[model samples]
Target chain A: MPRDEFERLDSTWASVTPPAARRMLIAAAAAFSARGYHGTTTRDIAAEAGMSPAAVYIHYRSKEELLFQISRIGHATSLSLLTAVTGDDPVARLASAVRVFASWHAEYRTTARVVQYELSALTPEHLAEVAELRRGIEGAVREMVEAGVAAGAFDVPDVRGATLAVLSLCIDVARWFQPDRGRTPAEIGDLYADLVLRMVGAKAP
Target chain B: MPRDEFERLDSTWASVTPPAARRMLIAAAAAFSARGYHGTTTRDIAAEAGMSPAAVYIHYRSKEELLFQISRIGHATSLSLLTAVTGDDPVARLASAVRVFASWHAEYRTTARVVQYELSALTPEHLAEVAELRRGIEGAVREMVEAGVAAGAFDVPDVRGATLAVLSLCIDVARWFQPDRGRTPAEIGDLYADLVLRMVGAKAP
Candidate 1:
C-alpha cells in the first residue's frame, strides 16, 4: 500500500478509543513490543505519549491496565471481524476471514506483536478476558469449518485443531511481517486465503 | 509419558551442554518464558537453577548468551529433525515433519516457548545467526513442499506461503500447549500431521 494508505489503515483504532487513551495505548504497544510489558515502565509510556509521568495513572490505574486495554481492544477487533463474516458458502467466508485476519496482523504489526505475543504480561483476570475473546475468534473459524464439512465443500478431520492452525498461521504473521520485507498485507491475505482453502480440502476454484 | 520418561525427554539438551551449563539454560528458558527476556534477570535464572547469582556468569557470560544458547540449540534441534526426515513420498515426508515438529513444541513447551519467543532479545549479530538457523528450518519445510508440488502430490498455489503456514501452525504449539489441559504430545502431533496433509492437498492415506 501507499504511505498515506498505510497511515490511514493504522489510524483505525483512533475512532474507537479517546484521543489521549489511544495515544497511551499506542505508546504502550510500541514499548511493550520492543522491550516487553514488565520492562516498560509507566513513565516510559507517559514519555512516549508526550505526557507527564504522573499522567499515566490518571488514565490507567496501573501499567497492567494499559496492557489489558491494548490486549482487549486488539482481540475484540479480531473477534468482531471473524464473527461478523457472513454468507452460506463456507469457502468464501473462510477466505474472507483469513484475508482480513492476515491483513490486520500485517498492517498493525506493532499492535499485534504485543497483543499476540505478550499475553503472559496480563494479570489473571485480564488474561481470562483476552482468552475468552480468542476463544470466540476460534469458535467462528470452527463454525466455518463445520459448515463446510456438512456441505461437503470441505473436508477436515479435526475442526478444533484446524481452527487453531488457521488462526495460528495468521497470528504469526505479526511476529515476522516487516513493512520493508516480503509481501504486502493484501498479498499475504490472498496467499493465506488460498492456503487455508487448501487446508480445508476445498476443491480448487 | 511417565515421569521418568518426561525426565528423559527433557534431557535432550543435556548431552550437548554440560550439566551446569544445561541447568543454566533450562533455568533461563523458564524465566524468559514466564517473564520475557527483558524482565528476566540473571539472578532469577541463577536462583531457578539453584546457583548463587554470581555463579551464573561462570557458565554464561551474560543473560543474552543464555538466550542465544537456548535459541540456537532449539533451532538446530528442530532443523536436524526436519532435515533428517527421509522418504520417497513427499506427502509422507510432510506428515512426518509436522508430527515431530508439533510434538517437540508440545513436549518441550517451556524450552520451545523461550527459544521461539525470546528471540527479540538477541543482539543483531546473534540474531542474524539465529535467523540463518531458522531459515534452514524453513528451507527444509519449503523443500518438502516443492517436492510435493513437483510430484503432483500437492496442489498449492503459493508454495512459500504454504510452507510458512505449516511451520507457523506447529511452532505456535509451544505458545499455547498446556500439559494439564488436554491432548498429549503424540496426539497433537498426529492431529497436526493430518491437518498439514489436508493443507497440501495430499491424497488421503
Candidate 2:
C-alpha cells in the first residue's frame, strides 16, 4: 500500500548537518524547481534562505555545487530506497521497487526535478559524481528485472530496453506530477507497479 | 522495419516561413538543447544563425518568443504525426502510434528537448496554446488505448493509468536519447511498440 502523506520538504535534507546549510540547500532546490539552474543565482538562493549571498558562498563553492549536493543526496536516497526492498519473489520485489521509486519522485518532486532535469548544468566533475549514483539506481532496477526473467516469473525479450522504459516512466513523475491534480504519489506508484509488471509480462500479482 | 536514417533537424520546422526566421528558430533550438532556455541569450541565437541581435527581433519579439515558436511547432508536428497513423486494427494502430511517437522524440531530439523539457519557460499565453496541442497528444494515445480495450484486444485494468504510462514512456525518450549510443530511434520505436503492446496486454503483433 502507498503512504497517505507527502514527505516534508526538509525531510530529505535532514542529514545535512548545520541547520543554516540545510536551509540554503532547501532554498536552492525550491528556486531551481521554479526557475531553471541558469535562471537561478546564488543571491536568489541566499535570499530565499534568508541569508546573505556571501553566506551561500561560505556553505557551497557555487550554485552548481548546491545543485550537485541536491542531486547527489536525492539520487542516493532513491537508490537506497530501491535497494532496500525486502522480498525473495522477483515479481513482488520488482513491484515494490517501482512503488517506492515512482512515489519518491512524486513525494520529493521539488528535489527530483532538480536532480533529474538539471544534469547538463552540473560541471563535469559534479555530473560524474551524480552519474555514479544514477548507474547504481539503473543497476538496481536491471538486476530485479533480470532476476524475474531468470526465475521465469517474467517474459522479456529485451531486458535492457524494458529496464529503460521502467526507469523512464518513474523518473518522469517529477516533470508532470501535480499535487492537486491526477492520482496521489502512492496511487501513481500502485498504478505504475501494475503497468510495469504487465510490461515485463509478469502475471497479475 | 525501422528507418535507415534519422530525421533531418530542420524537417520538422520546414513549414515555418521566411528562411531567415526558420534559421533563427533552428539556432534557438540547438542553443536551448545544449545550454537550456534560461542559459541562452538572443546574442547567442543571432551568433548561431550568423545574424545580428536586431535581426532576431525582426523575426521574434524576445528570447521567450523564439522558445514559443520552437515549442509550438514541435508539439503540433508530433500531434499530427501521431494522429496520422493508418490502420483499422487497434493493436496495430496503437503499436504504430507508439513507434512513430517514440522515434520522433529521438529523431528530432533537439526540438523534442525544448518541447518536452522547456515547457515551464513558455509564457502563459504561449503555454495555453501549446497545452491545447498537448491535450490532443494525450487524447490521441488515450483513444488508441480505449480502442484496444473495447475490441477485447487489450486487458488494461486502468485505461487512464495505462495511457499515462505509455505516453510517459515515449515522451521520456527525449530526456535520455543519444545518437552515438544505444539503439537508433527507429529501433527504439520497434522495441517500444512491442513493450507498449505488452503494457496494454495485447498479443504480439
Candidate 3:
C-alpha cells in the first residue's frame, strides 16, 4: 500500500456518495451479485432492500436498467479505487494497485461476482457499455505497466499479458475467499499485492 | 504437458466415451453451462440432445444426478490434464501444467463454464464431492510449488498463495477468451504459461 495510491482511491470516494442512491445501489448490487441477472427479478432486489417491487421501478425502468446501474457503479468504484492508489513510482503504483484491487474484491465480493459472471445476460447494448467500462479499468492498468516498463521498473515481454495476470489475481479472489477461511481480507490483500508486484518483476520492497 | 498427465486424461476419455453417455453428458454440460443448473429444465437438455424428455430420466435418475455426472467428468478431466503435464523439473512442470490447463479450458469451454458457474446449484453432497475433486487438483499444484522452492527453482514465501495465483490465471481464461479474440488457444496458452512461470520466479527456458 503506497501512500500515493491510497490518496488516489480516497479522492474517487469523495465524488460518489449520495446516501439514498448509494443504499439502493448496494442492495441492487447484492441481489445481482447473489443471483445471475436473469435469475434475479426486481422483486428480489426490492425484497432485499425492504421495499415493494413497484418501488424499484420508480428508480429503474426495468430489470436490465437495474443491472446497468449496478454494473456502472461497480465498475466506477473499482476504477476509482485503482486510480486513487496509483503513484508516481511504477513499482509502488503496481503494488498499491494490487492491494487496493484485492481489498475491493473482498469488500464487494458479491457485486464483483455478479459483474464478472452475469455479463452474458446483459442486452447487447448494455453488454457493450459494460464491456467499455471494463476496458477502461484494464486500460488504466495497462498504462501503469507500460509506464513501469518504460522506467525499467518491470521486465515483461507483453504489458497486456502482465495486466491480465494482475487482474486475474484480484478477480479470482471471490471464487475461493471465505470470511472464516483462516486469513483476513487485508492479509490476503497484502500477500497478493506482493506476489503480483514480484510477478511483474518489481523490486522487492 | 507431461506424458503422465496426457496418459491419465486419455484413460478418462476412454472410460467415459460410450456414445450414449458421452452425447448425453455433452448436451447436459452445454445446457447447464449456458442456462445454469436450476435455470435449465430437464426438457431443455433432452431437447438439446434431440431425445424425448423421458429419455433423460431413463439414463439419469434426476436433474441433480445429471449435474453431478457433469461435475464429475469436468473435474476428472482437469485433474487428469494436470497429472499428464507434470515433469521432473519444477519449472518445466509448472509451465507444462498451465499450458495444458489453458488449452483445455479453450477446447472445452462449455464444460469448463458449467463446472465453474453452476456449482452453487448443486446439492450439498454433490458440492462436497466437487470440492474434494478441486482440492486434489490444488494439492497437486501446491506440491509442485513446494518442490520448486525446495529445488531453488522458485522464490515464494507462501506456497498456497503462489499456487492460487497460478490456478487463477488459467481459470479466468474461460471467461474472456473467444476464438475470434485475435489469439488462438495455443497462443493464449503459451502466453499464460509464460506469465505463470514468471509469477513463481521460475527461469525462462
Question: What's the CA RMSD of model 2 in angstroms?
Answer: 3.4
Give a tens-digit lDDT track for model 2, residues B41-124: 999999988999999999899999999998888888889999999688999999999999999888776678778888889889
Error of 1 at B54 (Å): 1.5
Which residue window of length 10 is worst by lDDT in model 3 chain A? A1-10
Candidate ranking under lDDT, highest first, comes to: 2, 1, 3
Q: Please give me the DockQ of candidate 2 compared with the native complex.
A: 0.65
- The TM-score of predicted model 3 comes to 0.88
Full ranking by DockQ:
2, 1, 3
How does model 2 score by TM-score?
A: 0.94
The per-model lDDT (C-alpha) reads 0.83, 0.86, 0.75
Task: Provide the global lDDT of candidate 1 against the true structure.
Answer: 0.83
Q: Compared with the true structure, what per-residue lDDT tens digits does model 3 show for residues B1-205?
A: 2233334434445666565655566677767666666557889988877888998877788988888887888898899888787568998888888888887777666667778877877889989999999998999889888998899998778888888778877887776777676777788789887877777888655
Better candidate number, 1 or 3, judged by DockQ: 1
| lDDT accuracy of residue A138 in candidate 1 | 83
What is the lDDT for A176 in model 2?
80
lDDT of 1 by residue, A1-205 (tens): 2344335534867654567777787778778877878778898889878999888887789999988988898899898988888998888989999999998888887778778777877889999999899888888889989999999998787788788888888988877777777789999899899888877888655
Question: Chain B, candidate 3: TM?
Answer: 0.89
Displacement of residue A151 (Cα, Å) in model 3 is: 0.7
Chain A TM-score, prediction 1: 0.92
lDDT of 3 at A92: 85
